[model samples]
Target: MSKPTALIKFKAKLSRPATPKGAAWTFLVLPAVASAKLPTRSMVTVEGSFAGQPFQATLEPDGQGSHWLKIDNVLREAAGVAAGDSVALEIAPVEKEPEPKVPADLRKALASNADAKATWADITPVARRDWIHWITSGKKAETRGKRIAAACDKLACGKRNACCFDRSGMYSKGSMGAPEAAE
Candidate 1:
């Protein structure tokens, strides 16, 4: 005997009691369980039918080990099932997965710089990435060396907020001076 494959699509409704009249259910339900094998990343369309009118929905990975079913259209139209109504979610496979969050070090590198005012203002964090890319993207030592001193100097001041580890890192305002000698 071989494993069976699905031919006809089916609707799987949640086993929840319907919402009371004129009430709002504000919550998110994740990764609906079904008999069909839902591939991790696949393009899928889910349809909702109410009062003989139908609305189509899109389902994608919610990035927390579950799928995000978009109910934008269905929610707007008058339907038999309320928000908490035991709605059925039908699915198909999709092609792409959600993008991952940036690592802490990368975020620190992007957000902190010693020249807290100027360099930070010049570019958005995404743009900072380009600068980071240009500086670190280089394969040659001299090219990287050229930016070393000024970049470090700017960061050392602890004033810049956009490209260093600490966005609030600030240099003390104390003065560095010696008594003047009079002739």
Candidate 2:
């Protein structure tokens, strides 16, 4: 029997910028900036079949284009090649768009947080989940907040993920079982 080695590159896309449902058509035509240097990375769309399952690993450039993409968790899991299996790779560059920026106010609060850990304990489970999703999305903790002041402000202002969250110390959906929900 011959040992298998070398997965293949499949469908690859330089993750286009995040777009609202309405602006999608316009975004399709945005010009690409050559300096993004998307080609220098060694891994593009790694095409191959893994564990009888066909899959493609994608290389998405981080927002700050100073290096290769963040960890390609999809490929790592797709291709069972691990431990001693030697592997080969191929790569290419495409004009990719940056993901749309999250709303400034929500981004600011999430970015400027300072009480993440302790804040969760006091909030409801739903609120806790919101905080978790907000914090975990980032790749680095240094880029996260340690306090909830910023989140609280957004909540006070009724922002969503990219907007302000409604605070009032009351769950807007009445999930917290406030007087409003009982009536």
For lDDT, the strongest prediction is 1
Tens digits of per-residue lDDT for model 2, 1-183? 534323223322222223332221110110124213233321233333433445433342222322222223355345544322333333333223223334444455644554533343344543544443454444565544532455555544544332333322132342111111110
Q: After superposition, which runs of candidate 1 have C-alpha atoms over 4 Å from their true positions?
A: 1-31, 46-53, 73-76, 91-183
Backbone clash total, candidate 2 = 31
Query: Best candidate, TM-score-wise?
Result: 1
Over the full model, what C-alpha lDDT does candidate 2 score relative to the true structure?
Answer: 0.34
Estimated TM-score per prediction? 0.30, 0.24
Q: Write the per-residue lDDT of candidate 1 for residues 25-88, one digit (tens) a residue.
A: 2222333454224543222334434223465544433333334443443453454553434554
In TM-score terms, candidate 2 sits at 0.24
> Which 10 residues in a row give candidate 2 its minimum summed lDDT?
22-31
Error of 2 at 108 (Å): 6.2
Counted clashes in each candidate structure: 17, 31
